[model samples]
Target: ISYVFIVENTGNVTLTNIQVQDVLPGLMLTGGPIAQLLPGEIDSTTFTATYIITQEDLDTGSVTNSASVSSEAPRGDLNDPSDDIVDTSDDPNDSSNEDPNGDGDPDDPTVTLVNSIYDLEVSKEVDELEPVVGDEVTFTIEVANIGNVTATDIVISEQIPSGYVYVNHIATNGNISYSDITGEWTITQLDPDQVEILQVTVEVLGFGDYLNIAYVQSSVGGNDVNIGNDEDSAEVDPICLTIYNEFSPDGDGVNETFVIDCLERFPDNKLEVYNRWGNMVYSTRGYLNDWSGTTNGRAVVKDSDNLPAGTYYYVLDLGDGSDPRVGWLYINRKN
Candidate 1:
């Protein structure tokens, strides 16, 4: 970076042999020169410096540079005191120590340099894309440092969706803690080119669609440049098992078979068909969506020896430890 210093002679008499000096830590001065000044005359000098930022600079977040100017009386000037008498006393308040020329350099002034540039991103995922009630879903949160510099005291926050319940289980490569009162998670720090993954398990309480959001923050202060990617969201959709109430099995190829959407997802399942008299007329193990309203060697075909049209009941056992579903269904024959 480059800096400029201005030295002005506001005195009535002429001033001469003006000099300027720069004192800046963590920086090297390349070039700077000052010229003599006369009454009502002003001179300006520019200086260039270079510095490489370090961890201490990053911690402190600022660097300062100071510059000062001093001058001696011009030659052959009778009113101005000789240059030899200027260093008379060390006391600043003493007249002898003061610059006899009114155009003497002012007090030292400094400029501060501040550092503010870093990037952080967050992303989330779930083990099961489609979940159901009573099922446990694992959520994974990924935090990455995509900035040019390292970030310290990194923290992440998450709120469990209402429909999901926390299983009190978590996994991560970094040190983390959870607060139940605030319902959030916090982590320590993250370095450049580093990624931290946090995994948590939750049980699905209700069905439908749910959204979970997670956010990331760093203690590096204003150095975080991109706040847009600080937070990420993931959604979960549950597929519920449903059974039809009525269907026609009259060989018309439309609604002729008993169908259930989620029954196929479970391999070990069983279905039993019972008439209104409470007698099971048809039973099958591992129901594979192949119930054509046929029972007791009878088919619902026109003028064929088949079961009569009537109201029936069905008992479906998914064998997945869930409650068995018992509901009434109707079989209509149109021949």
Candidate 2:
């Protein structure tokens, strides 16, 4: 930064050997040392100086420099011969001195304020920790600015794992758009101590451990102060189930009952079967993979011992306080 000092002869006598001195380290004073200045006469030559700002200065928030002017006074006692030196130092207690900014100190010390820092933290969360297949899961992503300055043009990215399809998204303070596996959130500005939340919904196609990740991609500022909290991830494990859609209840002694893989894992489950007319045909608790073409004797068809071949619906509840699983089931007695 460049600095200019304009020294004026405010005293009554003529001053000689006028010079300027700055207390800031590494500051080099250039230009001329005026020879003499009459009363009420400002220096005609320019006395300038320059100093390079460092990272330490920026971190300190402000840089303060104090300057003073010294000169040689005219000889008054020619007979008693005395060396006279006059100096005008920056005195904060001097009320008569000029203080343009009026910070209560009349020294006129230069203070340059440095810009503040930028810090953005991201966190991710999932509504369902263990969801079933074909379930819609919602992920909440939050971005907070913990710095002192306002952040602008922030871009956050979301990475949707495989076996999951993007459904839709909603944001509190930004615009979001996504493809199949990748999504982007663009924010115009976020003030200090402000937070923005974005919720994305996706459908689980298959069963596995799905890990969704979100992070701060970029911003208009230089860089985030703390990068440790720039990214976060949420994990979900869907419960997989293998159901036999079509079953044969013929007297062949094979495939005579409905089978469901991993059903024994949840012994506290309840299975309910419904016909095409939404009528409950069979309902049982603690199913042991046993169910033939016969109903509970309440919805008997043409034959009292067996039902005709047709399509049916079933609802399986794991009794774990989760949503019940619903699907189609087929009964083929002719096979």
Candidate 3:
């Protein structure tokens, strides 16, 4: 990567012996040794430096560089008395060349370093795409740092929406803390080019869409340079479908027929019961909440006389173009 530094002369009098120095880590100073600068002069000249990005840099995302400048003004150009060289005994000009502090340089110069650039991106997902109410939903939040400098004290947070409640045992691959008071999950830091995945489990309390939004930001005392990718959200809508895992057709008038709670809402539905070998044992169209555990083709009345007691498979189709409900059903009949 390449960068540039600017040097300007703001004083009233012309400055001499102007010099610029840049001390940057992981960067080699290729050129930019300015020797002089007149008053009101500005060096907008582009300075060239080379830097090879490392795996760590790519993983962490960025590096910082700081540069400094210095110059000498003629004795008459001195505006403030404090600008004059300090002396205790002899003349200031005579002692000017003398080095009491022994630092070797008599000029004190200061320069403001370049500001940092930032880039952050976030993505969120849920483990259960078709979750039901009261089910535990695990939300995964991914924050990626794509900037050019290391971001410090990074904080990522997620606020549990109104239809959810935060659960215990939140998992993450970064520095994190969970707060019940705020119903939030927080990650403390994320380096450039690095990605952090945070898994938080929450219970779905409502039946409608469960939308969760999360945001990522640098809290290292400065704003993120790119706040565009700082926030993301994911949602899951629970459907109205239920299945019964067991039923008895003993004719005792109690739990005698296989039941589906919401299948009646759709009048064009179909139900198919299969034996252990995937053979269609019972099939019905526009089912009226009836399954006597007997094969539809059987000529006997009792379930034991027609189909033996065992486990079976069922497919419920609501004819609504949605996914069909499939699960195991136990046929418990006593002769």
Name the top TM-score candidate. 1
Sliding window of 10 residues with minimal summed lDDT for model 3: 84-93
lDDT tens digits by residue: candidate 1, 285-304: 88877787777522333322
lDDT of 3 at 227: 75
Pairs of residues at least 3 apart in sequence or in different chains that clash in candidate 3: 60-192, 61-192, 61-193, 62-148, 62-149
Model 3 scores a TM of: 0.44
Local error of candidate 3 at residue 222 (angstroms): 2.3
lDDT by residue (tens digit), candidate 3, 1-335? 66554666656777655445566567776555555667788776645566666645543444544455555547534445444322111122333454445655343222223434567788998888876655788888887777755555666667777767778645555376766566455666666577777777878754333778888633652456667678999987754455667878887898888876546557788888888777778888988777777787433334434577889888988888989888889989887
RMSD vs true structure, all candidates: 12.9, 12.3, 12.2
lDDT agreement with native, every candidate = 0.67, 0.77, 0.65
Better of 2 and 3 by lDDT: 2
Candidate number that wins on TM-score, 1 or 2? 1
lDDT of 1 at 147: 68
Error of 2 at 112 (Å): 3.0
